[model samples]
Target: MSEYHLDIFMHIPKTGGMTLNEIFKKQYKLSEIYDHDSFQKKMMNMDELTEVEKRNIKAITGHYFYGIHQEFSRPFNYFTMLRDPVDRVISSYYFLRDYPGYEMVKDMTLEEFVVKGPEAPNLQTLMVCGSQEIPDIEIAKENLKTFSVVGVTELFNETLFCLKKEYAWGDIHYTRKNITKNRLAKDEVPSDLINLIKKYNALDIELYDLAKQLLNDKLQSLTEDEQNQLKKFNLEQSL
Candidate 1:
């Protein structure tokens, strides 16, 4: 890995990103990492950071889109986690309904939120493609190709193993964060509501399918010893 290269973690909300962010905290020094929520409170945007500030930082993590690399002059690689569109949308709705600064969605039912919630449709595509207008799957796929790692929430431990190997990271162990308690499982949702979510998130569904294939391909490429190591890691975590 190049010492000068920046590691940009594009954290898609409700995609097991919080857990990964905690792992990132263990990997880099406090001064070397730029956290989105931390800087947003200070009203600082990525583009506003000085050259010195940018150069000193090693990793950037937050609910940011893909185009943040434009702010830096040095080499950079992006890594992000994706989730099943239906589950992600459901988790997001329940989490945000009670979350602060989102009072507008407090009374909306799942169906209502599926139809009208802000940033509800094709969120993954929007984040990956960095498009504020219509989200384009082709653009998202092209951008995903450039990511050093693309992880799926369904295969989270595998994703972490990949990250550990890719970055030579230490202490890959972690506890889950930002979980939505009492949330309904995808199967628990009414069929009609599920279809509505699918209608709104068609692009995300497609993107997620592609991401899963990519992750599987990456896992398949691991050497035999590496596969055994991954199995051992999972077993240790389960114990």
Candidate 2:
């Protein structure tokens, strides 16, 4: 491992990443930060960057996945958050549907979206597996273990506490962003469609399970005082 001062935040879609971005912004200088969406016109291959550009970037974040780690000469620690597979798929579907010019999913019904949308199958697995076409579940799980922290979206407060401990992060504060406005309630979604989503995203479901286990283990390891501190922070964050 190269000795690196950098941190790579793998911002998986609809995984509470937008909220984390607020925390990152407070911690790192604007120039040191590289927001892939705004700063990078397209996802540039790691080889495309000059050494100077790489060195200047203290933190990097995007929807990209596992393989980018190979591009950095300096040592870097990675962290990411995973959400419940079903909810993540639903959120992604609704969010993209509304994006102007991304009309392909806009007209799709929830069932149709789960059945045919581009993001329907194993997205998180494919991302971490570092292949768009053929994802390897074992590889994704192993890659996850290498992260400084792998958090679960449902357990946001505890996840943030783990981040604070693992990376010595300060300002574990955030406000939500990129919310899917007027999303359907859980009771409104049909059971059959939900099953179809589960069947299609089996690999993502497995990967999410691994993330949950990792996060749960971390939380269990904390002292009672630390856990209480995290609760206090979460309360403050809510305000």
Candidate 3:
């Protein structure tokens, strides 16, 4: 089987994860799992599952961050997106702070935010990606060791282009997410706060940098079914 057949689209929240997951499902017809807990909680809470259940899973999506400490490794791939920490935290803070599930951050500032708070987005980010905790570069790479095609969210279109050219897919375009319809700059984020965000989201940054280096102009390394699926969907959209 082609590497892309085992493609795993890791869900990194507040970074266009939702929109991208849709694309993978629309294109590949792979089993898409989101809301994350379905897999992470199942895998984390349970010690084992029957081989039938394992074969039933084609594409596990919706945020399994780290490498699960189990012998469930199969012919599968891994993938996710990364964004600038400063922007990610800021974006997440606004998107969910006032939402029902994120009541904790209803009135907190980035400087005031902590991981355990109700509005803690990173915690969810880790869970969705299958990691037990937040990631650093070395740790994330280790966690997603099974992934074959890792894409950078900030430059997602570029990554999609490569996936299209290399794989049988023509182009994997997706609608952007977490866009602010209005603009209001309340206060400037302190440089120190920005630095803190960068410090914490180091793993994402490293992944972005590494993906840029490794997958440059690389072709003939994609699954035909995945590629054809993407191409057909894109054409249908055009018509």
Best by TM-score: 1
| Ranked candidates (lDDT, high to low) | 1, 2, 3
Off by over 4 Å in 3: 1-5, 30-54, 68-73, 114-131, 134-136, 142-146, 165-167, 178-188, 202-204, 215-239
Candidate 1 per-residue lDDT over residues 1-239, each given as its tens digit: 68899999999999999999999877887768889845423656676777777788888899888888887788999999999999999999999998889998898988888888865889999999998778999999999988999999999999999999999999999888989998999999989889999999999999999899889989999999999999999998898
Question: Tens digits of per-residue lDDT for model 2 on 37-123?
Answer: 444445555566667877877788888778766766667888899988899888888888988776998889878887778766788
lDDT of 2 at 111: 80
Judging by lDDT, tell me the better candidate of 1 and 3: 1
Alpha-carbon TM-score of each model against the true structure: 0.96, 0.91, 0.66
- Candidate lDDT scores, in order, read 0.90, 0.82, 0.54
In candidate 3, what are the lDDT values of residues 1-239, reduced to their tens digit?
A: 36424456667666677777666666543232322445423433223444654555555565554553233566665666665555666777777665677787777776666343432434433543455654344654455444455556566665665654444463456666557433223246777776666665555556555655545433245467745755665576456
| lDDT (Cα, 0-100) at 229 in candidate 3 | 55
lDDT for model 2 comes to 0.82
